[model samples]
Target: MLSLFSLAHAMEMAAASSIRTSPRASFLTSSTLKCGPNFISKTSIPANLMEKGHKRASLFSIRSQQSEPKDGSVILPPTSDSEANAVTIKDWEIGRMQDEIVSSQGIRIRRRPPTGPPLHYVGPFEFRLQNEGNTPRNILEEIVWHKHTEVSKLKERRPLIALKRALENAPPVRDFIGALKASHLRTGVPALIAEVKKASPSRGVLREDFDPVQIAQAYEKGGAACLSVLTDEKYFQGSFENLEAIRNAGVKCPLLCKEFIIEAWQIYYARAKGADAILLIAAILPDLDIKYMSKICKMLGLTTLVEVHNEEEMDRVLGIDGIQLIGINNRDLESFKVDISNTKKLLDSEHRQAIHDRDIIVVGESGLFTPDDISYVQEAGVKAVLVGESIVKQSDPTKGIAGLFGKDISV
Candidate 1:
């Protein structure tokens, strides 16, 4: 009796051979065998698989007879019908073997890395660095020394520590959805969640004003549902001081601290700076991470706007329980490309139905401007839209809001 492993190995080899002769033949044969942990009988396999199996067997037999036996073994003549069958099998096997070789070679080529620059070396007494003015260390040491310098400067600033302390004693803000619901109930449309971003690595300094409190006030007066303040000082040219200022300014709109959010410490710090919500980008975090962080957000009374980019991201986000709001980001993080159509693609009717069934609020984020742009996203089935450029650049940012909605939303 063949062990399961041996049977599997034989099947793999047979499949490989079939592939080398012809892809279609190999596909047909492989489809016939059910290989899952709970293996059903061949007859019970899917209809498509059965069709492929029949096609493979016919092809395999034809190919087998074409090649003469290498050891001068007597080639038994087959009847007319059997001759046809043998020829079919022979053809398929040859095609299958060819395919297997090509595929294996392709994989090997892909795995090999390109040859590049050669390594540099010096004699025992011949130090390259020693020849220069600063000659005490090697390349690796230089990198470490620079890193140490940076760390020393960072310690001197103590920004994160100050942020932690500020958050620890900070009072909690109002709920993000509650604020949105209130705005929407008062008016017919969902209110804006305007972001105050200075510079993005992708699209540099967006707002010259760069005042968090002023931006927060403008957004609130313009009938924004909430304020999303970017706090990444390095890439976004944002500061925690901006969040702190907006919180202390007594702006009516609930605040969302927009950060990269790789660590839990940031969440606690955001809460300390009077943030009502946090943006969690799904591209960087796994489902488990999102679930864990979301629970932490809830414990701190902070709403999480789980951001996804595509169908796979949406599916991953949906699998995790307790997600109330989903934000479809128009900008691709890896490529840094912005296409407002991304929101449309992700918010299909079927996806909308799934979200509706769970009572999830879908927020369209990035690359939005004008009443038409706002309407486009709203019609696509988002509960709200996040805008930055068109509104922030206006002479009267408050009027920019009315311009976007085509009506006074504050009323």
Candidate 2:
């Protein structure tokens, strides 16, 4: 058996070799590191493993000769020099990759850096400098950053395995797309996906007496083909509990889990909690993630409402296969600006022909209040509409739906 010192030396040389051969980018200097007995010191990480398209950089496995623990639970390896170098490099690569990706697609919103911000030292003090890499540029970016941390902890508590088992007792998946089509045909206008939202970052607390199940039942009674329940607890003041509660209350409207989905694990979690559909924003997720997540939704018998804010995002989602439902969110999530004309702009663009060809159902979302606003988007080619504040704030949410459409659409 090799001594600890010799083993560390060998590993350091191997790591250095890997870094030198990498082609994407290298941000580490060749230097040996020493650590305590419980720790492993590494010099560098492989470059090829840190490619632009590779998302597994932050999830690399650590190989150590430490003895196994008495408990069967997985052991978390102690932090090492190589891990620190890898994390810093991962942050840098993610930022660079996002720049390239966004340039091609014009996505201004940046993903939260894979690793947290780097630390700067000033003599005896340490400071974390704020930049695009560490700081969130917009509300949407900030929410995503918090979500990355939130989902990590949620996964630890109720892993994918547990979520799968829960699905055995989950409510049957409802036909979200079919409901929209049926409602549109029945109502002679865009079908409503009434939102069960209590609050939003842009507009605080829409309803003080918020009862998710109550709101859901009212919306269904008012002829909403589907319902969108915000599951983001931080920014939206919504939760999975609300979703489960509404579904268990026997509301027939297909429940859409309105969440900033960053991981595939969230898709399963939503299904297990009684969601018939889930929202996937094109601004935050790459094309690969969208495709993968959409497939998972299909397998779980869940519908995906892929949301886009601009022509670039609309174009990106159009290229992907198996996309049946697309949402044109009039509100620019980055700027928190609402423009009802965004829907018309995208539909009138070159994408309209392609969207028609694919038989894609486009849903106009946000900034829609009056019947004229509803008419504008319907003429712009949306088969559905997702409205929240205009309807949810009324003394009777059922009556609010009539005011929005200028007539009662209930059955």
Candidate 3:
């Protein structure tokens, strides 16, 4: 008598052969194929496929006994009802199963190559929607969707184990959160956490000479409380190498790894790559994720700079339990529009009082240049400012920083 495991293994073999033979056969045999390690039969057979004629015959006889024939001559089993219900080749479940099999076997399946519409030169870059019906609801939704997709792809490519290993051995940088709190208490002035960014999707390339370590040193010399480094490779043209280099360059300022914070894995990865703090954009993340990630950052001895662009975002950041530094980004992330008035708009009298009561360090970000711009945001209730382009573009970025502050910040 055939053991249950042997019977299941035979069934799986039959199913595999049936799938290879015809789409019809695949549907007929799929129901019998069991999926588990214990399902593999311990039955012995000739090692070679060419020498297994008798074994094949015995398997066929067993299948024939299990499935009744329909006609005078022995008939093959009926295809599955689901297979019959399929309207077209594209809709066939058996075809999908075949694709999955091919994928599992590590085979590259390719469709027929497109024959030609002669490629014509387009004068300018054009935005064409691939699926018009599947439009995002708004700019915020669009960015969130993009972030989700990007993060999913990253997870597949870099598993969590690898990220943890990277984090465990990563170089350490200065802590932005600690620096901010210390500056606020000591000087009664918010810590100057300036960002070093090159290009943004919304606003092309902001700075011409983009050297991460050099920029970091300049910020340190200019009396910046911390340094924000863009570490996104695709959009920002940044890398972990930049963060590592900045830390190794002997710059004393705490470094914030400016990235789209989607997963806790990324936080660990940042810590491993010498990041002292991270920017958690309130626009994309829900409050729960923010709070959870903030706690994780604290546990890792890292700081979290919760960034907000509007009143709703600000309120959300405030509601989170452990946020110490609040960065008010003047540049609208979705529309790529920059307005200095955004700092003033969000930091109203009521909000200011609430922030002061909590002793939160508010850092004004983007569109800052010259002494007037710096003074404008400072007077409007921002204790510190994040300026990138105007300062970085100057012959000596350190001088540009003094020019913006209008006094020797180094002194």
lDDT of 1 by residue, 1-411 (tens): 332223334655664464455423311111112111111122222234344444232111111334543434443332223223333333333334433432442211110111111111112111011111232133322322343344446446656567567666888668898877777678777568888877776668777766768877888888899888888666678888899898888887888888766556678777877888998877655555577789888987889999987778897788889999899988766556778889889988888888999989888888887778778888888877777777877767889889988999874
lDDT of 3 by residue, 1-411 (tens): 332223334555554454345543222122121111111111111113213222221111122234433323332232433322122122222234433533443322211111111111123211111111134444444544455567668779888788787776766645566766665456544456767877766667877677777878887787777788888777767777888788878778888888877667788878877889888887666565577788878888888888888888887778767678899989876666889999999999888888998988788998887778877888888877777777767777788777777766662
TM-score versus the correct structure, for each prediction: 0.62, 0.78, 0.64
Show pairs that collide, candidate 3: 170-272
Output the number of the TM-score-best candidate.
Answer: 2
In terms of lDDT, model 1 sits at 0.63
Model 1, 156: alpha-carbon shift in Å? 11
| Position 8, candidate 2: lDDT | 36
lDDT for each residue of candidate 2 in 81-165, tens digit (9 for 90 to 100): 4445555344445556555665566666665543322221223221222322445778998998789779989999999899999
Ten consecutive residues with minimal summed lDDT in candidate 3?
33-42
Give the 10-residue window scoring lowest on summed lDDT in candidate 1.
109-118
Task: Rank by lDDT, highest first.
Answer: 2, 1, 3
lDDT of each: 0.63, 0.78, 0.62
Backbone steric clashes in candidate 1, count: 35
